[model samples]
Structures are given as structure tokens and as C-alpha cells.
Target: MITAIVVALLFAMLVIGTPVALALAVSGSLGLYMMGGTPMLMGILETTPLSTASSYELITIPMFILMAEFVVLSGVADDLFDAAAAWIGRLRGGLAMATALAGAGFGAISGSSTASAATLSSTTIPAMLRQGYEPKLATGVVAISGTLAMLIPPSIALILYGIIADVNIGDLLIGGVIPGLLVTLTIILTVAFLVWQDPARAPAGRSYTLREKLSKLRVVAPLLLLFLLVTGTIYSGIATPTEASGIGAFGALVLVALARRLSFGAVRASLLRSAEATCMILFIVLGAHIFGYFFTLTRTTNDLVALIGTLEVSRWAILAIIMVGYLILGCFMDQIAILILTVPIVLPVIQSLGFDPVWFGVLVVVTAEVGMVTPPLGLNAFVVARYTRRPLGEIFGGILPHFWAHLIVIALIAAFPAIVTWLPSTMGR
Candidate 1:
């Protein structure tokens, strides 16, 4: 009865066009009231939001987001993409491939999929279109590849998952490294394969001189340094993810100043955008906390855990089911909201089945990354389509290959947990 009310209220609020955070809060409150009456509901309402927001680990989110904004405003994305294109654009479908690689590079520091998609789309789509790249392919690649932001280190989703699930943030961050690179490489290979199969779909070549390539290297140097400085610090235990984020944001500001791109107007705009995003994320998180508390009060997670234990299926099969559920949920909900809502229920079940939390977090992140490129409700796809002005259908179609690539990687990681665990284990994190 509690579950039904929670689901109904959540869907109803969404249908009526409430903001996601407010909807989560309303639905959670409804569930709490139904299960424990007004006292429980009032307690949750008074305390949950503050508790959720005060988490020290979550501080990484705004810092990473601010770093991305500064990088974009500083014109760093433009330089990175330009350098990427110069090196790869000569090959068939090279620009598209380059966009994926560059998106991965930019994602390392940004850690926000929407921001990466918006920045990359604004910079690369026009250039690719001018170069005679297919609209669907160009926009699709950018949209899908931008999701790397969530899978790479410094990711906001990973941080949230770590905090909620009590997994090591460093482990979750390192766990993503190999899988993220594999996905990027898979996208590149997919583009190469498609172009090879139908050469006409992508124009041939424009080789650059050695000097030209070297000249462009300077353009992407700041991005590389920033990535290494932030991720390297985390890997070396020199700083916590939150501290690394602060360092990254500071580095980005310095880069902007060095490039003479910093201005009072730009600084104001970046802060405003970061604050808006941070508030939206925090509200959803707070609502999820209330909802999670409500679930606990009703013993929903406990009941669900018991129900899963009684199932005859193997744990691997159950894991597959959970991944599929995330894939479906990812379609309708934003990544952070999905994590906040589901992890409380799912993590207990996963641990009961003997799976590692860090590995599971990576799996969840990869699946959610796919949701970013999946149709109709994919925020990244929408951002790309809006920016490129391409028919939404084309962008959706273009993402199919990359989507398959991500699924393949997810399967591989599932089959061989070492892929996700090796780095974190090696670091003793």
C-alpha cells in the first residue's frame, strides 16, 4: 500500500508538470504520511533535506560543475576539439570519432553530462556539418559521447552513489577509468566501422602537416594538464575528490585568466549557472532522502531484500534484472534522481547477493550513461538536437551504435568484475 501510494504520487506529480525535486518531495511526503502518519512525515520534512545536503562528500558536485563551466567559458573546449579534429579529421568519419574522444577528454574535468553535451554540441556540430558529416551521426556522437562525463572520475553521479551507498568515493572514481576509456574507444571503432561500410556517408581525407599538428597540441595542453592534476591527485591519495574539485576549479580559473578570457561578466554567469544546477541536484537529493527514509519506515527495502532472497534465479541473473530496471528508469528520470531513488532499495539487495558495491556503482553508472543517449527523454540527445537543430529522429538513430557499444562494455564488466575493480583495488582505495 505504501509503495503504491509512493509510485502513484510520483507519477501524478510528474504528469502534472511539477519540478522533479518538488515531485520527489511531495511523493515522499505522501508515502511517509500514509505509512507513519503526520509525526513521521513532519520529522522527515524537517530533517531529511538538511541531513542530505550537509554531506561532506557531495561538495565535489558543485566544484566539478564549476570547473566545467570555467573550462567552457575560458574557450578550453574549443581548443581541445580543434586540436582533436586536426589530428583525426583527415580520416573517413574522423571528425565524428574525434568528437567522441574529445568529449571523453573534456568529461574528465567537467563531470556533468549535460554541460559536456552542450559545450561539445555548440563547438563540434557546426564544424562537422560544415565538413559534410551526416547530421544524425554528428549530433548523435556528441550526445552519446558527452555521457562520458558521468562515467569518468570526478563524476557527480559517482560521488552521490558513493555517499548514499557508503562505498569509497576513490574506488568508485577509479573503477570508472578503464570502462570509460573502453566506451570511448568502442565509440571510435563504431564510427570507423560505419564509415568503412558506407564510405559515401563520410567524406575521405585532409591530412595536416607535422608542424600543423604540433601547433594544435598547445591548444589541448591545458585540458590535459587539468585532467592529470585533478585525477592524478585523486589516484595518488594526495587529495580527496572534494579537494580535487576545488583544485580543478582553481586551475580552470587560472587557465581562463591565462587565456585572457576571464571577465566580470563571465565569472558572474558561471556562478549563476553553477548555483542553479547545484540547487536542482540538491533538491532532488533531499527529496530522495525523505523518500528513502519513508521506505525504511515501511520496511520496503527489507521486504524487497527478503523477496529477492526467495527467488530461484542465480545472483547473476538477478543482477541483470537490476541493470535492466535501471535502464528503464534512466529513460524517465535524470541520472542523479534515479541513483537517489533506487540505490537505497537496490544496494542492500546487491550486497546480500555478494556483489561489491563499488563494482555495482560502475555498472549503474554505465547503464545510466546509455539512458542519456536513448530516445524521446534523453536529456543529452535533446541538448544536442536543440543545439544542432537536427531532426530528433536522426540523433536517436545515430546513438544506436554507440548505445550497443556501451551495452557490450557493460556486459564485459559484468562478466569480468576485475575490469571495474582492478584500479580501485590496486590503489587500496
Candidate 2:
């Protein structure tokens, strides 16, 4: 009953719009106090904050953010987007399709949905509007495609899940590569199909020569190199995740200079943004640890396992039930909050069922991608709406069809877990 009350309070705090970190901290602290009084609460809170904050792996959080910030401001992403437009803007709905492709490129670097959505929406929407594309088509594509940021490598969501679930972070990241590419392909195919059926939505585009396309690729070379550097080093076991991030940050600086895009102003702004993002992520991590401590004290995992055992259902059915629960939560809550709150509780059950941690981590991220595009609480959708000054309803309308693309990708992964598992298994463990 007490565990039930604590869970209810936590959900209440979330529903009332308290920051996720604060909601977690308050509910956790309360549970600790109730369990063993003031001294216990103080001990748990004090140690958790320190230990969680001091993790060496945490250093990469700031570094990754810094790399993304510098890359965003370096004008490289705009170059890439323009290049994509030049390459594929000739088909019906080609511009919108290019925007989604560009979202994938930017996502590969940023590992952030909001950054991908805002950046692409600002650049793509205006151009698409000028070209006579429908507003909903333009906005919806950006919102849904931006979610690829979390699916692709160096993903902040995957990093958090790997940490929380005690999986190999590098393996988890590598595992996302195939599924991420599959999602990108599906989105592109969806765009082509939509455009083919209704040419009125997006007018036929002008063709570009092969020479022109190759020439445009020259401008975005450095950004591609940086991706190879970071991801390659990790895959080859030449650098740890943290070291790769540091190198990536340095690589970003070099690219900015070589491209004649560096300025003190950009550097300062990037630093400020990185600092702010790092603090927010760290606070959530700290709060999760605090909440996890209290949750363990209540022995919830054991209870949950016992409850599951009572049901004579197959473990596969149980997995489906969990996925459905996550999807429902995705429609209403923040993805990161859902991840932090649930991983600790489910890790034991997952192990009991003999599920692979890395594969499960990929599925967790895929499910979160659905939330990034869903209505009412889709962060990427909201970012697009705010930046484009469109009604949230219109954006949600645009998102509806593309949303199924996300579900299809998830279903594909669920049917063939090997898509996620094979790459990680090849990694040098």
C-alpha cells in the first residue's frame, strides 16, 4: 500500500507539471524518510548525488553536448540540408523527403531530437513553403524525422538507458546503427509513397545533374568525417565512449576552423548550452539514483516478479504487455523520465526472462521515438510547432501518417531482434 501511494504521488507530480528531476527527488526523499526516518534519508540522498555526479562516464555527457552545439552553429548542418535538397528535391514531396534525410544527418551528429527538429524546421519549412508544399506535410515530416536523433548512434536516450540498465554502452550504441538506418529508409519510403499518391501536396521538383550533386557533397565532408571518427573509434575499441566524445569535440572545433566558421561568440554560446544541458541531464541521473534507492528498499522488483509469475502467460506476452505500457506512457509523459523511472524496476524481470540487455535497450529507445512524434506531449512536434508558429493540432495532423512509420519500424525490430543484436554481438567485448 505504501509503495502504491509513493507511485501515485510520483505520477501526480508528473501530471501537475513539476520538473521530472524534482518529482523524482521529492517522491524518492519522501519514501526514504517513511522507510527509515531522517538519518536514512540524509545518508541515501547525500551519497547518491555524489556517486552519480562523479561518474567518469558522465564527462561524456557534457562533451557530446558541446560537440553537437558547435556542430549546429558551424553552419555545416545547413550545408548538408541544402546538399540533400539538391540531391533529391526533384521528386514529388522531394523537398520534404530531403528534410527528413537531412534530419537523419543532423541527428547522427546532434543525438538530440529538439535540435534536429528546430534546426531543420527553420531551414526546411521556409524553403518548402516557398516551393508551394503543404504546411502540414512540411511540419509533420520534420517532427517525425527529427526523432531519428535518438535512434541513431551517440544517442542521449540510449546512453541513459545503457547506464541505468547496466548494459555495455558501446554495444548498445552499435546495436542501434542498423535499426536506425532501417527507420531512415522507412521514413524516406513513406515520403515517396505519400507523394506518389497525391502530387497536389508537393509539386513535382526540378531535376539536378549528377555533377551538381557530387559538388554539393564536398561542402559537408568534414561533418561526415567527424561521425566516422567518433563512431569508428568506438567500434574498433581504440577509444572509450568518453574519450571518443572528447575527440569528437576537438574534431568539431577543427572542422569549424577549416570551414572558416569559428568565432568566439559561437564558442561561448556552445559552452553555455552544453553546460545547461549537462546540468539538466545530471540532475535527472541523480534523481533517478535517489528514487532507485528507495524503490529497492521497498523490494518492488521481487514483488513485480512474483506478480508476473502468478500469470501463466508466456514471457513473450509479458514483453508485449510492457511495450504497450510504455507506448501509453509515451503518449503522455517525457521519454527520459519514463526511462529513468522504469529501467530499475524492470531490469530484474528482463533478466529473469533471459532477454538481451542491449536488444532491450534498443527497443526502449525505439518506443521512445514514438513518443517524440506523438501528440500532446511529443517534444519534437512541440519544438516544430513553436518554431514554425503553427497550431499544435495541424502539426499533430501531419504527424499521424508518419507516426505509423515509427510503429512499423518498431514492429520490424520486434519480429527480428537480430537486427539489433547482430551488430552488438560482432563488437569486441
Candidate 3:
């Protein structure tokens, strides 16, 4: 009952618009003090923030964010969209497919959903609109395709999940590649299917000659090559995830310089943005640690695991329930906030069911990706709406098809865990 009340208070704070980091800290500290006393609260505050914030592995977050910021400054997203559009510009709903593809490429480079969605919405949605595509298909594809950023390699979500779950970050990142690619292809096929069912949704895309496609490819190839070099080192056991992030950040700078777009202002902007983002994530991590410590004292996590184990239901059923819970929660909260709050709570049950942590990480991430496009508070949907000046209702409606695409890919991964695990398992780690 006390555990339930603490959890309820936390939820109430979030619902009332309290900042997540602060809510976590206040609720957690209060819970500990009430349950254990001032000594306990002080101990948690003293150790949790210090230890969680100072983890050596935590440095990877800022490095990756810096790299992504630089890549954004380099204007790689525009080139990616142009290249994908050129290569696949003739099929029914081809522009949507290109958006998905370009989103994937940008996800690889940027490792952020909002960054991918915002950039693509501003760049591709207008082009699709000018080509006479339906608004739903145009805006929906951009928003849904942005989800690939959270699933793909160098993902911020995967990095945090790995760190929190105490899994090997390299293997966790590699594990995402297949699942992410599958999600991308599934999104393309969804667009194709939607257009096939209603050709008016996307009549046709502008055709590009082979030469034009090849020429456009040059704009994005260097960044793709940079991604390959950095991630390749990680897969080949040549660099840790941290080192790879540093390499990626430097490579992003080089790519920008090569494009003659690098400037002191751009670099400075990237640094400041990355620093802000990094600080926010670190604060959230510290708070989650303090909160997680309170859960340990309450024994709520252990009790929940035991309770679940004692149930007559199958593990798979329990897993489904968990997934559904995530989907529901996704509708109401930011993915990062949801992860920080729930992962520590449910991880014990997940492991008790004998699920692979890496695969579960991918599943958790893909589920959260749905939130990025779902209604009421879908961040990506809002990004699309803001850029296209479309009604939020229409944007939400447009997102459903892409939401189904996410469901289909998630089902495939669940059925064939190897779909997410094979690549990472092959790594030397």
C-alpha cells in the first residue's frame, strides 16, 4: 500500500507538469525518509547521484550527443533525404519509402527521433506535398519514419537501456541493427500497402534518372562511410562504445568541414546543445538511481518479481501485459521518462522470465517508439504538425498506419528473437 502511494504520488507530480528529474528526486527522497528515516534519505542522496553521474560508461552519452549535434549542424539530414528520394523516386508511395530510408540513415548519424522527425518533416513533407501526395501519408511517413532513429545503431535509447540494465553496450547496440532495419523496411512496405489500398493517397513520386540518383548519392555517401567506419570499429572489437562515440563526433566535424559547412558558430552551437542534453540525461539518471534505491528498501521490486512468478499465467502472457503497459504509458509520457521510471521496476520480472536483456532492450525501445508517433502527446507527431501546419487531429490519424508498421515489426522480433539478437551475438564481445 505504501509502495502504491509513493508510485501514485510520482504519477500525480508528472500529471501536474512537475519536471521529471525533480519529481523523481522529491518523491524518491521523501519516500526513503518516510520509510527509513533521515539517515537513509541522506545516504541515498549522497551515493546515488555521485555514483550514477560519475559512471565511466556515462561519458558515452555526451559524446554521442555531441556527435549527433555536429551531424545535425552538418546538414546531413537534407542530403540523406535527397539521396533516398533520388534512388527510390518512381514507385507508388516511393517518396514515403524514401522518407523512411532517409530517416534510417539519419537515425544512424544522429541517434535521435525528434532530430530526425523535425528535419525530415521540414524537408520532405513539403516536397511530398508539392508532389501532390495526401497530407496523411506525407506527414505520417515523416513522423513514423523518425522512429527508426530510436531503434537504429548509436541510439540514445539503446545506450541508456544498456547502461541501466547493466548489459554490454556494444552487443546491445549491434543487436539493434537488424531490428532497426526491419522496422525501416516494414514502414516502407506499410506505406506501399497503404497506397496500394488507396492509390489517391500517394499517386506517384517524381522520377529521377540513374545519373541524377548517383550524383545525389555523393552528398550522403561520406556520412554513411563515416558511420560505417565508426560502428565497424565497435563491431570488430577495435573500439569501445565510448571510443567509437568520440570517433563519430570527430568524424562528424570532418564531414561538415568537407562539405564546407563547418563554422565556429556551428561547432559552438553543437557544443552548447550537446552539453544541455547531456546534463538533462545525467540528472534523470541520478534521480532514477535514487528512486531505484528506495524501491530496493521497500522490497517492492523483489515482491513484484515473486508475485509474478507465483502467478498461473505463462511468462509470455506476462510479457505481453508488460508490452501493453508500455504502449499505454507511451501515450502519456516521454519515452525517456517512462524508461527511467519503469525499467528498474520491471527488469527483475523480465529477467526472471528468462528473456534476453538485449532483445528486451530492443523490444522496450520499439514499444516506446510508438509513443513518439501516438496521439495526444506524440512528440514526433507534434513536430510534423508544427512544420507542416497540419491539424493535430489529422497528424494523429496519419500516424496510425505507421503505428501498425511498428506493431508488425515488433511482432516479428518477438517471434524470432534472433532477428534482434543475431548480429550482436556475432560480435566478439
Q: Which stretches of candidate 1 lie over 4 Å from their true place?
A: none
lDDT of 3 by residue, 1-429 (tens): 767778898989999999898899888888898898998888778778778877988888888888888887788788888888888878888888999999999888878889889899988998888888999888888999888889887899989988888988898888889888888888888898999999999867778888998899787768778788667888999999989998888898888898788888888888999999999999888888888888988998898999998999988899899999999999989999888889888888999999998899999999999988887789999988888899988888888878877887777888789988889778865
lDDT by candidate, in order shown: 0.87, 0.85, 0.87
Write the number of the candidate with greater TM-score, choosing between 1 and 3: 3
Q: Tens-digit lDDT track for model 2 on 1-429? A: 778888899999989999999999999899989889999999987788789988877787788788888777777777888899998898788888888788888877778878888898889999998989988888988898888889787788888888888778888878989988898888888878887788788987788899999999997777788888777788888888889889988988887788787889878888999999999989988888888998889998998988887888888898888888888889898898889989998878877887887888899899998888786788988899889999899999888888887788887888789999998777764
lDDT score for candidate 2 against the true structure: 0.85
Clashes found in each candidate (C-alpha, N, C closer than 3 A): 0, 0, 0
Off by over 4 Å in 2: none
User: Per-residue lDDT of 107-155 in model 1, one digit per residue for the tens?
Assistant: 8878889989999999988888887887877888899889999999878
Q: What is the C-alpha RMSD of each candidate to the true structure, in Å?
A: 1.5, 1.3, 1.2
Evaluated against the true structure, the overall lDDT of model 3 is 0.87
